[model samples]
Target: MGLFPTSPPRIIAQHLQLDLSIRNYRTPAALSTQKYADLRNEHTFPPFAALPEELDPDLSYYEMSGFREFKHSRHWCFLAEISKVEWLARLRLVVRDKQGALVPVAFYTDDKGEEFKYRARKGSTVMILYPDQHFFLGGTTGIRLEKESFCKIVTAPLNELMALSDRVGRYSTWQAGGRTCHGCDEKKVVDLQKCAGCGMFWYCDKTCQTTGWQSKGHKRDCKLIRENGLRAMFLTDRDRFEHFIDFLLPEPVTASESTAAAVEKLSALSIGTESGGSRAAEQTAVIVKTPYKIQPIASKGKGMVASTWIPRGTRILSEPPLFRVPRDNPDISAVDDIVVSKVSQLSAEQQRVFFDLTNIHGTEHSTAMGIARTNVLPLGSDSRSGGLFPIASRINHSCRHNAQNTWNDNIGRLTIHALRDIKWGEEITICYLPTVGSYRERQNRLRATFKFTCTCELCSLPCVYSRWESDMRLRKLQKLDAQIPGLLWGDRVEEKTALGLVRSMLDLFREEGIQDASIARAYNDAYQLALTCEDECRAKVFAQRAWEARCVAEGADSPTAVKMKKAVDQREHVKVPELDEDAFEKWLWMEGES
Candidate 1:
């Protein structure tokens, strides 16, 4: 269940996953999650950046998930040769990792595979983003093209980032001013540790230290570590992790010049930008943007306020999530712990902002999970994945929500658009319930899910007079839903029956103060029915009506609006000849088009 004060609106909730839990536990982290960097392995075989495999006893699927979790949050490098390419339904890149293990990397969804047709080739060198969906498990393909700034190809440099990940492994142990094993990557956590000759190098055993001096190259590396004052880096007791080092990819052409040369080479790839802006080819020129401000609400804590007049269909607020969690995962504690770990890595100021957000779980086991549950919005097509949008979350709940919250795939951002015009200074709101129902139903849902009774305009109508009329309309709307299918698909459909249903649904939407995508869709259905009868000019008017409704909710630049615009521009269809407006109505719906 959601942590918000109202039941999730019907439309939005249809795609969300809800897990209900009520428990509190106090568990402090055993180790601090700290700042980490993507460091290049200067020597040796690099650390083991193990991909999850069943036969490997040294690693578990759980640990591999954590390693992937760590890599997905920041910039990561992939080194591989394209072993196979499948371009038909989707872009699937099968590449061999540094270990010579073949892994499948899928990018983008269905129709988008064509955009990067040239890049998906055999034996091509590519640098995929760290967090990309590397479906290492059986059956499923890897990577999805839907994520932001998904990946880029470093055409010139080859295999520079293919080294094993040093970021993982033995990060748990740290000691300063004490002797530690120099030769051991798997040294025990405590006891039996002694220093070698220089008082700088440590080893667990005499034989190990001796071998390290000659065979493991500690002789040269030790002298360099001591002389260069890298002893601190060698130890793990420091309060903070090391900052990121600039490592150029593909061609570390002479290690010395790779820094400057790499940046120049990768400049066209837009390396550091969080998500693409103009880089997204599908986005149209924005007409108006969502505008709102955050302010303290009486007893509600903080709420989003419209800073200016927000027109219907204006994409009011489009923002990336601070972080995300697997939506369908039933384990609440695990998800909450992951969020907490991510928060620990943020700057103190950023941490404060995250901590200050509303928590429906007052003192529940997980404050992190509480805020996430209360504020999380869907990430993709469904609630199986969700991200917490800091600003969008603050837009308080209303039974009669003024805005529509959607996961906009084109921009890869959580977008809130005004479903209805919002006046300047008005408190911006979105519906928590999946759909508006009876007053009692709304009340019960709000109490059960959010633990607060809603006082929304539609929900607060008294049971004596106001509730009756609203409930009556709602029941009728439900009945209409069942009738429309038969009229649309049945062979003996009467034109008047379909027309009556459309008019009633339109009136019901208005009476309920509803502004939704369905309104436009319903009008489009009428246009299609007219088309079935070859009523061209009459269908144009219905098509125009559908387009107007769409413009008010999706804006003129949206894909749906663009498609509607194309239909409106097809003026050639109206050449069939126009009937008088009254006669047109009778012929179109009441009487058959004869």
Candidate 2:
């Protein structure tokens, strides 16, 4: 017998100890079931059937099974507080419908963990981690909901989320089918060999291990992956790591800086001016920047738009160092709430500016922390918190985004550009969540971390269409992964072959209207192919695009961006020999556009 004796087996209707819940209850349904099914069919592959442990209580085993199918729009709500600020262990979101049907989403354990969303469609809104009560809505709707509409609401301060940092790992909570080792393609039988120092890559034998270390790019990448804190992220259970990425990472140095310092530095610089340009000249530059605001439009969460008109490919804004904290730094040992409350003592502007910086702390803290936590973007290399851009924060969330933002190390400022066109009043958005994997995986992530059940058109579709999207994604990743080992070994791809594969991926993104991070990697692969063919012009073009995308995804100021820029510049100015066409094609996916 099931909990619902007469109907299908459903989850516990009420709160299960320490469970996560649906915050928004009123999700609107508009499209017909058939249309929704068509849309789902248009993108996803592999129907949604219950995967083994898709939503497990333990922070591990989070991958969605291809077999599970979604039946209806899910409703998740933040629940009432259950314990003291620091020692609180469980998190529960009240799941109820606009019609009052109840579902309880629980993170039921003393073990602290973090959750992350892998895919969210454009136009989906994710609440700030520790949002004020004003944003909660119970139903999945396109319109933002009033906090008052939320019933049986339960939530704790953002400080509580931050206090339990070790327990939260971004993407650490989920597990997937075992991946075949790149070197040997071994399955369950393979022995694990951890990378020295960095401890990220695994090898099956001494020969494969040596090839990975010396010939493959693992030697260089191992250190970088560890330094950026991504090694642990990709290898660990995704759910736990998701929390870490979403909240636990130290606040970015720029985010913690004083407003006085930011103003003072901005005033002292000759940005967008000749060496002796006056402060008036700099002010003019700021005005010019206003029109070039990079609008975010592609993914759910992280929406941004120009306060004014931005031209095509315009360099929108640059950021200066607000603060700098080294990796492995420790938080000040004090009650987070108490420490956060101290911001009230600051001047209003200072308080405002402080909050504008990136932080994982939520409401109930000093007003400053809450505000800062609301608008920060990842700095890529910086393990601390992501940085905050005042102008950029105004953008909104959409799964299908248009603008791209990058941190430029050379100029020491953030830059933004239109990934696609934008009109005035259209909300700009960047995916706050990773835009990868199937629909269900993405929704689970958004609910766990952002506290909203996304009902964006992409997520609201039937299971069949969602599966199409997943299949395409899986194909791209598999193809890309196949090329890594050979390319890193200094091998090459023929131009025609490389072009063909790259074109396929690009075409797929266009079809889905997604701004995939993988596109950047594909561009880089193309650049390598061009280099192999001694096609300087093509190489330069691909490298430039690769650098720009990487800048947006990672910080422009990050080492990766800096290196890519160097390569781009070199491609433009230098010439090199072409490799054997056969070797090149084998090594890189250089299938030309047919």
Candidate 3:
């Protein structure tokens, strides 16, 4: 099909001609004849003269008709002006159609109407494509906009858009035989210079162009046409719809390039980095083969399972957030708006993956917001913001997780490392809790915060005695953890006592089978305590252990791991008598002294 219906040009021109004739015939008898004459003289060319004689043949076109002519079965495309905006439980726009009828336009997108909140203002012209009448539950019929790609908001009013369209049709189309000068109304056989601003209107000379700009409202029209890219949209074919398109739509991606692009964009933010230039670029350069695959677990909806044997200390995955949300925002509506805006910025494929993520919040929040709230991982332990990672989000939670996730600020990505050897087909899991706790405490927190019951291997220990012993060890570890912090920079506790508390926490970690970053953190705490006591030999051993543990949990590239490595390397070497493992442990902890 050609751009717009073949008959629209003739039909619109006839309608304009008839309207002008009627106005002219009634002008002499009216008391406002002189006012009308003055208004007519203000413009050099009549409005109808702006209308083109022909439409482009490359694009498909729909009839330029009123909403009243629309049928429920057929898809319709048209332009309307927003008369009123309703921000209630749902966003609704009351628009004035070409027939002057008020029609409701309701948004049913993933973010509801929040995606269009910026542009859904009174008098803004909305260009809608393939819209169908929606029968509301309240017995009202209105247009439903389900996909963001199917609509665009031109910041100008509807009447102004009509005028712009007319101008674009008249001047933008190329004619081999001759072109009409917009200012002089003279046909030129030779090529005419086009207006530099809009590049739509042609002029025979500089003087004529100036006349067109000042006398024919070309100045305002030129600005609107150039700013909005109105002429390109008119020339481009938009008959086919595929995925959701947004304002200032990016260049189309081929099917072959889309998968890689989506993975790169969704997995990494590529923003400011400490060491690497862009996290996305660094990851792209070193293509780490995925060791896990997303599949359904028995109780969990979807989880990442090992596709191959993943050894301990191996980096499973490193990913950046698809989008980030502020963690401290108390206003639910404001948060929803933020999520909607971020989601709208993603590519169509990335958006689909984002929406497919788990939404534990359910009906309480919008779909986009719910997915964000359910899957967001903190940028760091004490971060003010959290991000949603597409692949990392699919890893299910386990009390006894075989892998650990740490936010590495140096690379600006979340790195996942295997804490234990994961057999082929085994599920790769991560602990979601901030700290290890007793069975009851862990269950309560998981159930309340994540809306799920813990049934991981640790939580499902068959023997009651085993469970009890595990809880006791965890309680002792928590108590030791609390006491170690106070002794860090204070004279409240003796130096030996502070080192002993951290050593006890490490012992409990072994007894409790905690192989995550907590073990590394405990060793670091012990290293700090030894340094405070000016024990270089003991501090070297503690720092080495901290470095090793951190490397296994957060990878060697982690900032904390690098710092621990530096601490271990920078200290002076101390000569001591060669001893066995048991004797070395006693000496490192200074057990024989006191």
Model number with the top lDDT:
3
Q: Per-residue alpha-carbon lDDT of model 1 for 53-144, expressed as tens digits? A: 21122222122222212111122334566787654224667777556667676554324455555655666655442222333212353443
- Residues 340-371 of candidate 2 have per-residue lDDT tens digits of 55555656885575654444456545545455
How does candidate 2 fare on TM-score?
0.39
In terms of TM-score, the best-performing candidate is: 3
lDDT for model 1: 0.54
lDDT of candidate 3 over 107-161, digit per residue (tens): 7554667778777889898866444344442346667665565577778898887
Least well predicted 10-residue stretch by lDDT in candidate 2: 1-10
TM-score of each: 0.47, 0.39, 0.51
**Residue 588 displacement (Å), model 1:** 5.3
RMSD of each candidate? Answer: 23.8, 30.1, 25.9
lDDT of 3 at 282: 17
